[model samples]
Target: MRPLVYEQTRFSPRVIFDAGNGVFEMEGTLMLEDNKVFFQTINRWWRIYQQSPNPQTKIVCKLNYYTLATDNFLMQWLYVLKDIPNVELIWYYNPDDWEMQEYATTYQSNYSFVKLKEEKVR
Candidate 1:
């Protein structure tokens, strides 16, 4: 499958979904006013990838900020990932950002497949 790579923008995050390498990652902030279209593409890509997933898939999320719509989409995405085997989600948050930490905690609490980690200062 072709990879989905979107560069980070002022209103959206950087998304890299490479099914061949089993590297699915998203980083940066997401504050788009109309996120439906953006998320729709991701949902479609995910559905296709689900048909022939890799042996081990790791989804890395490093979001500093996001709107409620993005959060809801992420939660739904996690729900779908839950049923898949050998899939893990690593949520990385800034240690200094309490809100991000809280979000990570929420994901960890609800999803056993989610692993929370502090983003290393660069």
Candidate 2:
């Protein structure tokens, strides 16, 4: 399957879903006004990816900030990954940000199937 890449916008994040490499990553901020349109496109692509997923899938989420709209979309996306057997999810955050850490913890608790790992960065 061909990779799906969405360039980052002022109000959105950069999304890279590489089926070939089994590396799926989303980085930067995500607070788009047109969140539904953007996230649905990703949902469609993920459905297709689910059909013939790579042996090991690594998903990295490195968001500087995100609005609730993005979190709404992410819950859906995480559920999709929650069902996948060979998925590893890593959420990176600044070590100094307690809010981000709490958010990650809450998300990880809610989605127990994801095996979420919180990575602290500088």
Candidate 3:
């Protein structure tokens, strides 16, 4: 499947979903007023990728901030990964950001495939 990439914008996050390399990552802030249009392509791509997924798929998420809509979409997105074998979902949060840490914890608890990591400073 072809990759889906989106550059970060003021109201959206940067997304890179490369099925060829099995690297799916999203970062930056997501505060869009409406996420349906933005996520539609991702949803479609994911559906196609699910048909013939890689042996191992790794999804990394590193966000500074995100809206409730984005949060909901994330949960839904993760749910789709549940049925895929050998899928790993990693959520990275800054060490000082308690809210992000808690959010990661929540996701980890809800999804067995989720793994949380404190972001390392460069």
Candidate 4:
């Protein structure tokens, strides 16, 4: 299947699921006028990704503002990741947002954090 790319609008978000790169990045805003339309697209991408999928997927959520409804949507998003054992999520939040600390904790175990370095390995 071809990679899925949805451009951003003022009230909505950008959806990109690149199977080749093994990266799925979601950024920008989150304000869905129709909840059905919103969840349908996301859920389809995830469900399709699960079939004959890439071995590893890195998901990023760099939202500027996530509303309560979006939070619920996020739960479904995470559920998609949970099904794929190899899926890795990197949830980024500004350090000043103390409330996000609990979220990070819930996403990872205390032992999950380790020093990371960037380099191409053979």
Say which candidate scores most in lDDT: 1
Reference-based TM-score, model 4: 0.76
- Give a tens-digit lDDT track for model 4, residues 1-122: 67778798887778788888776877777777775678777788788878877766667766655566666666666666677756677666655555444444554542232112222211
Q: Candidate 2's C-alpha lDDT?
A: 0.79
Off by over 4 Å in 2: 113-122
TM-score pick, better of 1 and 2: 1
Per-residue CA lDDT of candidate 2, range 14-53, in tens?
A: 8899988776988888888887898888888888888888
Clashing pairs in 3: none
Q: Could you tell me the lDDT of residue 112 within candidate 4?
A: 39
Give the CA lDDT, 0 to 100, for residue 116 in model 3: 88
Name the weakest run of 10 consecutive residues (lDDT summed) in model 3.
113-122
User: RMSD of candidate 1 to the true fold?
Assistant: 1.6
Per-residue lDDT of model 1, residues 1-122, tens digit only: 99999999988899999988778999888999878788888888888888888989899988888876778887777777887678898899888988778878998999999999898522
The alpha-carbon lDDT assigned to residue 98 of candidate 3 equals 86
Error of 3 at 21 (Å): 2.4
Name the Cα RMSD for model 2: 2.0
